[model samples]
Structures are given as C-alpha cells and as structure tokens.
Target chain A: MRVVLVAGTTATAKIPEISAAGADPTLVGHTPSADAEIIEYGDTVRSPVTPVSPTGCPTPAAITRAVRELTGFDVLTVDAGLAKPTAAPTIDVGARPGRDIREPEPVPTAPGAFEAARRMGLALPEDELVIGETVPGGTTTALAVFRALGETFPVSSSLPSNPTSLKEDVVAEALESAGLSPGDAAHKPKLATRYVGDPVLPVVAGLTVGALESGSDVTLGGGTQLLAASALARHAGAAGDLTLATTSYLADDVPELESAAAELDVDLVVTDPGFETTPLDRYAAGEAKEGAGMGGALMLADRMGVVDDVEAATLDVLSRLDPQAVDGVEDGP
Target chain B: MRVVLVAGTTATAKIPEISAAGADPTLVGHTPSADAEIIEYGDTVRSPVTPVSPTGCPTPAAITRAVRELTGFDVLTVDAGLAKPTAAPTIDVGARPGRDIREPEPVPTAPGAFEAARRMGLALPEDELVIGETVPGGTTTALAVFRALGETFPVSSSLPSNPTSLKEDVVAEALESAGLSPGDAAHKPKLATRYVGDPVLPVVAGLTVGALESGSDVTLGGGTQLLAASALARHAGAAGDLTLATTSYLADDVPELESAAAELDVDLVVTDPGFETTPLDRYAAGEAKEGAGMGGALMLADRMGVVDDVEAATLDVLSRLDPQAVDGVEDGP
Candidate 1:
C-alpha cells in the first residue's frame, strides 16, 4: 500500500523526528524534500490561524482546495460549521439531537485529490487512510465542535509548554467568549465542541465520516484531529479502525484530551520526545516556549517508528524549497 | 508563599533545559536564596517498578514510598487492596459501592516528612497539602484503576510508541487474565483500576480523601495523578480545591485524562502552556513519558507566580545534597 502522509505545518515540523522514528524519509515532505513528494494545496496557506475569535470559521473552500492540491484525493467537506453567534441552551438534555446546531455542510473539498489518487492507480479500497490536520487554536475549535454536537465538556486553551494556569486562562477566556461555562453543563463530546470551537474540527469530522463510509482504516493525526474524529464516530454510530496520533505535550497541555478520547470511543497513540525534547534552553532561559506544533509532530513521527534520522530529513526538507524535489525523492522504509 | 522545588533523577537529565527555563543556579540547594528555596529529595533506593502484566499495577509499597518521599505531607492509604486475587465480575452495576474492589494500600516511607512540616509550623488551618506521585506504568495502572473503580470505558495502554496490535494485545491479555471481558460492565472508576490497574491510583484516591478530611487545597501532579484525583473526587463525594498539573504530552498520550477531568465534580484547574509559546516541545528526550511528577510540580509552582525563578529553586534543591545544608538554608518565597 502506498502510504500518503498528509503534511501540514505541524507534520512538516516533525520531519526530522519522523525520520528518526523509522518512517521512510522518501514518503515525507514539509516544504519540498529531495525524498518523498510534497503536496501543496492552494488553499493551504500558513496564516496566523491563532488568536482567532469565535466569530468566524475557516473557509471551507480553501480547505477543500488545499486537500485537493496536496493529496489529489477525492475530498469531502461536510458542512459542519457552527453558528457565528452560538446560543447557550438553558435546559440540559442527555444526548439530545441538534441541541447544539451548526451542523456541517455536506461538501467535499476539490475532487482533484481523490481523482488524482484514482488516476495514479492508488487503491484506497479497504486500505488505511490516515487523516491529519494543522489548525491553530484547534483545541478551542474542537471544544466548539463537540459542544455544537452536544458534548458538554469544558474545553479550554492549554499552556503548550508547562501545562500551567496561564494556558488555562486563555482556554477559559475563549470558552467564556463562546458562551460556554465550565462545569455548568454535563460535558458531552458534540456539545462541547460546538459551543467553544474552531473550523478544522468540522472538517475532520466530515473527513472521518467519509473515511468510515468507505470502510477504510483511519488514523487521526494530532489531538485536535482525534477529538473531531471521535465526535464523528459517535455521531455516525459506527466503529472501525480509528487511531489518534499525538505527542506527549497534549497530555499536559490539555489533560482532558484523554477523557475526550474515551468518551468518543477511540484509541490513542502518544508521539515521542514531544514537548519535553525541544531543549528548554530557550524557555528556561526566559525565552518563550517556541516551536510547539512542529516540534511535537516531528517528535511524534520519530517515536511512532515512522522515520529515521530526524535531523537529516528535516535538514533535507529545509534545504530544498522545490515541490518537485519533494515529489520525486525515493527514500523508502 | 515559599516555592520549594522537589528534584528527581529526570530533572538532573534536563539540567540545561531547567536552567534555561529561568531557574537561578544560586538558589537551588539546601539553603534558601533571596528568590526561592530548595528541597533535595534524592532518588530513593527503591527497586525499579515494572509493569508485571498489562494490568500495569505497581507494588503498593513502591508507590507509597515514592509518594511519601516526594511530598513530605500526611499519607492517606486506601483500604481497597485485595487480600487474594479475585475473578472479574461478569455483570455491570452503575455506581454501587463495593462493585469494584481491587484497590491497593498506601505505604509511607518518610515517617517524619509529614510530621516535620507540622513541627516546622507549616501546617495550615486550612489543608494546604499538595499530592504528587512516582509510579511506573501509571497510565496503564490508570486504565486498571478506572476499571477497578467501575468505569465501563475501554481502557488501553497509553503506548503509541508500540504497534497498535501490540497495545491491543496487552490490554486484551490483561483483561482476560483478570477474567473480565471488554465492555462486559459499565465502566466505573474503581472497577477499572482494580481489574486492569496500578497502585498509584488507590493511593491517589486515599490522598483525595485525605484532602477532603483535612479541608485543604490539593494539586495532583502528573497525568495519572490527575486521573486518580478526578476519580477520587467523583467517588469520594467531596468537593474542594483540586488542581491538576501535567505536561502537554499527556494530552496526546491519552485523551482520557481530559475526559476524566471533565467528569470531575470539583473545581478543576489544569495548568497547560500558554498559547503565546509556539512549538512547545513535548516531554524532554531520554526520560520516560510517565514519570513527570516533579516537573509538573515545578510548573505548578511557576504558574502560581509565587516563585521568582523556577530554575534557581530547582538548583537550590539539587545543590543541597547534604541534609545539613538543607537545614541551614533560609526559607524564602
């Protein structure tokens, strides 16, 4: 089976760590590597997705375009966007349907990605189709997505470095701004995500639904990815191969991720040398903790036995800026 | 509010990282410096605890000693240890006492640690105890502990580093050995821990009870520690100040930790990293992902904003290898 690692900013950061984890470098790419091919989706812009308010969700069209450009796989975009001004329900109902609106729109990203897969004679039938994401402030979006889907858990921003109250304050502010109060409602998966959430969650949820419908073994990459995947699984009422790939940093950043996984009924896999590995030299020296998503993904890829020679792969990718070079490299497992 | 950092072997490995995180070297010794104070708890000569079975329950004495040494506070041991092995129950009961019973006993190592705090006139009229633990294979133990506590969720090892099948096999084997079938019973906290469990959990449960009885503010250090704390809060029928200190890694390691915190009926404070910091490294490299008790405590101290320098506090404790030096250091906030 030809493995397609959907590279994002987060995954790209982990190129070196992924290589160290034993993955074939030929199959990975951040910008453009001399090894594995790079998939550059037109819509996949590296914008400052952080500091996003609950007012807007990501442009679905852009996401669709990006998926098409990167994977060349048939992408389905579910219309799972939340209402701009979310309403806080006063009454509590156990697992009520549509209690939290903002149902996802059933739209697929460009059919190009999927069509390209077909054109390349790639057989995805019954094969594992791993889906990962890179949504800054994704956890907040996850909280909103779950809330809209009827989950009641309090979702908040986590301090990426130390998992301290400073991070919790950001999460709490986001949640409050979104009209969700911690510990007020009985936390369910869908409800939590919808009330205080982000855009990528619905995207992942839609993708998970599509993957399951196709009967493909799916691995959801990152903690936010898994949260969306788990919510989708619960909503669809089906169970198949769905695994969560994340770094140890999430364990501390949002201790609630594990419980969310349990509620969503999914499996979890911890990526190695997560936040801990990024030499604290900067943060300990009063430098702000930097390089979280990328560092974590790289570390995760390495720990999962996915790649070898993390630094080399990272350096290789960093050294090259050509997309074609990324596509033509033959580093294999 | 004096800041006292507890040092462990893992911290020694991350000295440069710790130093980089703003710790002052001059303050890290038995003697208190201008900014902070230090407490050196050398790694005990306790035998290395391993996961005997997939159940991953640690020896009670080992966990107790570690906790006792780490936190020089009162020890509260739960009386749920089984005298002999019992077969897993086949039926599920929701929230019934004695339905899950495989809890372990708490063992105290430093008899004077708790008393010394009182002698030093540090006892608060309000309980000011903070609980921490050092149990190997704690996440696995958490799964068992949850099961033993009657949590019906399908608990698996938080080992993404290994093959998916291998983790499943271990979880399945452990369940089988315990004579319990997956999903056979409604998952509860106590039952889960008992059947597929570890010792740190019950000890944590006891600590929660201790905190409640003492009416003190409690912080559960580490992901597993938080998990146990949440479970204890749920089962013990107490509501007080209970905080969780963990790393971002745990959020990725297992989402269940997040889920459990949400289930908590008490005040929940999860100290994660602030979003300002980008590219947060997961856990520092070369250390076990599970042994984060001391690190979490340090972060918690930092988050309180009471300590001027975490690095200095840690070093001050490290420098005070001699017990006499520890006594001579002037305590500072």
Candidate 2:
C-alpha cells in the first residue's frame, strides 16, 4: 500500500499566506486533518471543514480519492504529526506538530518520529510504495533544510509568486536562531530536522530510507519537500531504487528542479496531471501547485493505465462536495 | 497479518493485586507498553522494563515472540490506549488510556475510538485477522462490561489464585457508580464501554465488527476480553464468519466459558499450547492465562504446522532474556 503522511507545523500559522492548503489561516491547522479524512473516507465528515484553497481550488486529496476509486492501489494516511489530530484512521508515527523554525528546537519529536516511521517503512507489506506528504508550509521547511545542508536550489511554492524573499527571510532567521551555518549539518541530516526543519521532513526521509532498504520500489511524492527527503536519504547512505515524483506545475515554476534532482542522484519523474477545461486547469495556471500527494496519485493512475479516467473522477468527487461550486467553473470557448 | 492491540487502564492501579500482567502495580501502566514492544521487536528494546508477573512469570508476549519466530505469520501491534506510550512501532486507533471504572465515565474516548477502529477494521488489508488485546486489569473491566450488557460469564485472571471477590466488588461498585444496573446497556454495547469498560474493549469490538463485515475472517483472541468484543459485535448487528479463540488455560479456569460462547452464537476454538517439559509449562499451572494474543498466535502457529517448533522457540527466547532465569526452572524429572 502507498502511504501519505499528513502533518502540521506552526510555521503555517506563523506565516498563514505561506500555505493555501486550507481555506484560511486558522483552518491551516486542520488541513492535515481534513486531508487525512478525504484520503481515508473520500469525504470530510469527520473534520469540521474541508481542505481547499482560500479561492476554492480543491485539495489534492480529491485527486487521490479519484485514484482510489479507479485504480484501487491501496492508500493509507500516516499521521506523522498534526497540531489538530485527524478524525480519520491513521498510522501514528509518534510525533506532534512542530513549532515555527525560528525556535531553538522546531521539532523535538524528530528522532522518535524518524525511528518509528523507519520501522513502519521496514514492515511495509507492498512490493511498491509511494511515500507522500500533506504538510502545509512544508516547502518552507524544505528550503530551510536545504540551506542547512548547503544545497543552493530554490524550492517551489504553492502560491503563484515564488515568495522567495519571504521564505528566505524566514529561513535566515531560523538558521540564525538555531545557531546553524550552511553545511554545518551536511554530514548529520537528522540534525537539520531537529533544529530548523518541520516534523514531516525527518518522517518522510525515514520512511523512504527504510522502505528502500527493504528492497521495495519507493516513490517520494510531492515537490520540494520530497526533494528534501531524497537529499536526506542520500546523505544518510540509504540506497535502493528510489524515485522522486512530482507535477510539472512545480517543475514549470522552479527552474532548478531538474538540477536538484540530478544533484541528489535519484530518478525524478514529472507529471502533467492532464486536466482539460476542468477546475484542475488551475494546476497549470500556477495556483495551488501541489500538496496532499496529488502528483504521485496522478502518476499511479498513469501506471495503472487509468489516467484518462482520473480527471472525470476528480470532477465527480468535486461535484459531490458542492454541485454549485463545480457549476461555477467557466467553460472556455 | 495478525494484529494485537496493547492498551492501558487506571483500573489496574485502583486495586493493585487485581492484576499481575505487570511485575507490580506501578509496572501495570507500563505493561501494555512493554507488551507492544515485545511483540514488535521480539524483545523489550523500546520499553524501559519487561512485562512479567509480580513473581517474574513472563508476559504472554514471550509466547507471541515464539510464534513470530517460528511460524513466520506476520504480527503487528495496534495501540488502543496507553497511559505511557510504547516506543515500538504501532497502529494507533485514536483512543487514550481510560480511568478506573468506578468513575462517572471510565472511557470517554470510547465512541471516537470505536468509530476509528471500525474504519480501521473495514480497511483491513489482510485476509485472516487475529484481533487480540493486551490491557492490564482488563478482566475486571470485562466483568463490568458483561454485567452491564447482561452477560454472566466469569472471566479469567493472570494470577494462580483468582482475585474473584476483589474483582466482583470492583465491578459491583463500578456498576453502581455509573448509575447503571445489570443489563442496563444490553442493546447499547457502546454505552457500556463509555461508562464502565476500558478503551481496548471498544477498539477490539470495532475491529472485529468491521473486519467481519468486510468479509475478512476474524478470530477474536484472548480470554474474557475477546468474548466481550464478540458479544459486543453480535449485539451491534455485525455478522460474518467469526470465532473466539483462546487457550485451554482459560477454559480450564472459567467453567461458564463454553456456555458464554454458545450464547454469543460464535464458534470457540481453544488450544492446548503444548509446552510440556518446557519453561512455558507454567502455562498449564495457570500463571498467566491467555493474553497478548498468545492463544491466537498459538492457534495460527498450529494452523501453519509449526506448533512443534513453538516450544523450542519459547525456550530459546526465554533463555535469551536471562540464561540464569531459564536455568532456575526445576527439571520435571
């Protein structure tokens, strides 16, 4: 079965605009909770609100739900850490939501969560594994982690504007607060996560390492955060058939993505999602680029030879959410 | 894959001698933690202490370790509730450790845990599920749950001299404290768990019911707790090929067990465990009567035709724990 880790970080709360995974800043805390429910139950019945962009772009869980309906590739949500716990059934990795990265120790649960998630990865029952994440503001953590390890690539953003200056300011203050210099933790990948990274970084990294070591073909799903995980696994000496998969939306936005994949020495596959005259056309227009494993779920649909059905299935899922919302989409001539 | 749920309760501390699942009352809270670790890692590597009786009879996790070593049947621990959490990798069912049943509401987490576990059950990926639980002082809670639900089966205890009267007094007072009488929750099994039962009860019940409804063959393992789960499932209108599997150790003590199985309309399978001339022969002497899914693991080992190898494995595992302790057992000859 494939796994998507739903997590939270106070970084989203600190810079609410840094993430649009939820409808609002306060709901950002519940995005992981709502995303977990969508992955598990195909609806947000357990959560008080749905995970949608402030402007109403569907959470990637809608695409994930479409994949579940079509391909039947087993999927489960692993709760790495969350400020607000999900009402969906999830595999807990012994973590709690981390504080904003400016704190001395942003993720105190790092070591234990890494170890726990590693064991979880080692015991994965499937021949193929897709490790994904749904942490809002995770790319900011990825950027900080990359800086800590002395990587120079700029990470992509969920928002249209890259928000590079703001992310850089956040990461700069964080690195300074944690008394860390670039390349100081190049040899100790775990140290980066303990200091300035969010909880999802170490967890996704551990799962990738363990699953790869167990000889399962693993795909790290999502964009910059997954790149961060692959880099961590690479530095930690975990080796196997590993792939970092994400959407062209990210690749289109971040010019350095291909070179970053090359520097990590891992296979990287970029997907287009192929939505036509649908609400998801926003993906290509640089709105809500990727989160909640959308890129990986789309790739799986392609592999299962059911890619043609995903867009329709996604629209159907969105219609179920609110018919008027789907009806509100404009049809281009 | 077989699943064992490890949980904790405040009930064990309320009347210390009422349980011997741990080495002492203080260790009782850690029993589930230790048991979960033992099952996951084949030793108490993640736990601060081992799960042993007050006099040092091993926890049933030893036998489970033997089964894991011998039969190669997959085993995983699901955490239902733990006052002190285990460091071992576990599936969380979203419940917290419950209070002593004498309180107004012993298990406030019951409803959510039940719903979460039922979702867990329905999503079960394995074909044959052996659902077991390890909760210290569970028998007393089982007695209260059964009384509240109008069942009259006497439960088994870990100690050689069953603390029957103490259990009865505790249950009687708990029933009264909750403003409930006998049969008060006959049709509301969930209510019994909320008011007087432990967290493990509702979780196990939900797993059994959801697994059963999903058409996965399920065997409820352990003594009275499994029976209580089956009874709850039956009363809740969940039906499928279901069996309550326990050890002859429990059958040897509780005479009404067969009648209870008959009343629940579920097939009952009792195994001998066959530990003759081995350290585990203490099982026959009734030291620790069927817990940590020992009966279910034994039954699986027997089904896999590795029952003969299990005895030697148990000895090996025990010797590894402490060679001196294994040598202390007297030779039967």
Q: Chain A alone, TM-score for each of the models? A: 0.47, 0.94
Q: Cα deviation of A9 in candidate 1 (Å)?
A: 67
Which parts of model 1 have CA positions greater than 4 angstroms off? A1-333, B1-126, B147-165, B182-192, B239-241, B252-256, B266-268, B272-282, B285-292, B303-308, B312-333
lDDT of 1 by residue, A5-103 (tens): 321211211222211111233222222111111222221122112111121111112212222323233221111221111010010011111121122
TM-score of 1: 0.30
Number of the predicted model whose TM-score against the real structure is largest: 2
On the 0 to 100 scale, the lDDT of residue A209 in model 1 is 55
In model 2, the runs with Cα more than 4 Å from the true position are: A1-79, A83-95, A98-140, A148-196, A202-333, B71-76, B91-94, B125-127, B319-333
DockQ values, each candidate = 0.01, 0.10
**CA-lDDT, candidates in order:** 0.34, 0.77
Clashing pairs in 2: none
TM-score of each: 0.30, 0.66
lDDT of 2 by residue, A1-333 (tens): 555554556563458568767667877887887776676556664456766666666677778878877875545566677777555545567788888998889888888888887876776545778877888888888899999988887888777677788889889988999999988889577899989898888888888888888888888878888899888888778878788778878878887888888888878888878873566786677766777787788788888788888888987777665443344333311
